[model samples]
Target: MGTADAPVILVTGASRGIGKAICELLATQGAQLVMAARDGEALQVLATELSAHGAPEPMVAVIDLADADAVAGLFKQVFNRFGRLDGLVNNAGVLHEGLLGMIRAEDIDRVLAINVKAPLMAMQYAARLMSRTQRGSIVNLVSIMGVNGAAGLSLYAASKAALVGATRSAAKELAAKGIRVNAVSPGFIDTDMTRAMPEAAHARRVASIGMGRAGTPREVAELVAFLLGGQSTYVTGQVIGIDGQMVV
Candidate 1:
């Protein structure tokens, strides 16, 4: 069981990249973690690593976020185990690239299911737990493509944009309950996946950023930590971008 002194925070998509960084930073903040992802092996590795580093041993919930029943079960376990939730990071999302006209119906459904529907459902569950305590924080991971536009990524952009609108609405409706909701829009972040682009292609991408390089997962995680932490209790309903000032 977790004590009130160490907040119980639930983070999804927590096995790699920005999600992994967020987990590391939050651990340093002394939070009791509940990590949810589909990769049982990877999640366990991270849990052990964090515990070794002196953070509370995280409770790992392996579930497919796209399944509504799995999502509900995730929350049910949280409530049953900890009986409270102080924070939530709706970070699970899928980005499939394709031309808008040629995209398959199944592809579109998959994108919306994980990107849009999962977070929406997670927010509902978190809100219920948060309302009981009259306090909590939610940070949704959106993208620059959501607000701006991207070729071959229209479906992904649309899904992220949906979360942006949802974030604002959730903030307003939950404010009276003392829960803050916000979205983090990352642009040209330097992750293992993004860095694998051909040299010239990567250079062009970085050249567009005023910082002369792509933003690191750690940089993105720091901003997310602030919004989730007590430091930014006054910040809510905003789409804060960490893009190194990318022109896109």
Candidate 2:
């Protein structure tokens, strides 16, 4: 049973990169974390470290978001164990880059399943729990590519764009219940995924950004924290970009 002062937050894709950074910062804020990801070992390691550092030992749900049943079960476990859900961060997603004509059906399905459907389903369950208290917040991790066009990232962009639209609709539907939903559209960020880009391409991308550098996962995590916390109580149904003014 969690107290009011110690809110319970469920963060998907919480094993590494941006997800890991979000969990790390939220731990410091005294949040009782429910970490979900396919990497059980990594999740356990993070749980151990956070516990050792004085944060509450996070509840780990090792799940493949591609499996709809597994995603639903995760929420069931969260409510059964914690009795409430105060916040949710839909950070689990896949970026499959392929040109429109060359893209395959299976690839599109996989990307949409993990990126779009998973978040929507998570929101459905989270909203049910949130409705009980009439207070909760959700932050969906969208992408700047969803807002702008990218040549080789058509499928990824489509999935993200779908999430962005859903974010607004969900926010409106849940707002009357005192549940706030919003999105974070991250631009090029310094993460394991972005680090794999070719040197020339990465350099060109960075040079184009107004900041002359890629944003850090920690920077995005900070915005997520603000939205989930009390500071953004009046903010809802909005998508804020953390792209260093690149998209502008």
Best-fitting candidate, measured by TM-score? Answer: 2
Which regions of candidate 2 deviate over 4 angstroms? 1-5
lDDT of 2: 0.94
**How displaced is residue 84 in candidate 1, in Å?**
0.5
Cα-based TM-score, every candidate: 0.95, 0.97
Candidate 2 lDDT tens digits, 37-101:
99999999999999888887899999999999999999999989988999999998888776899
Clashing pairs in 2: none
RMSD of 1: 1.7
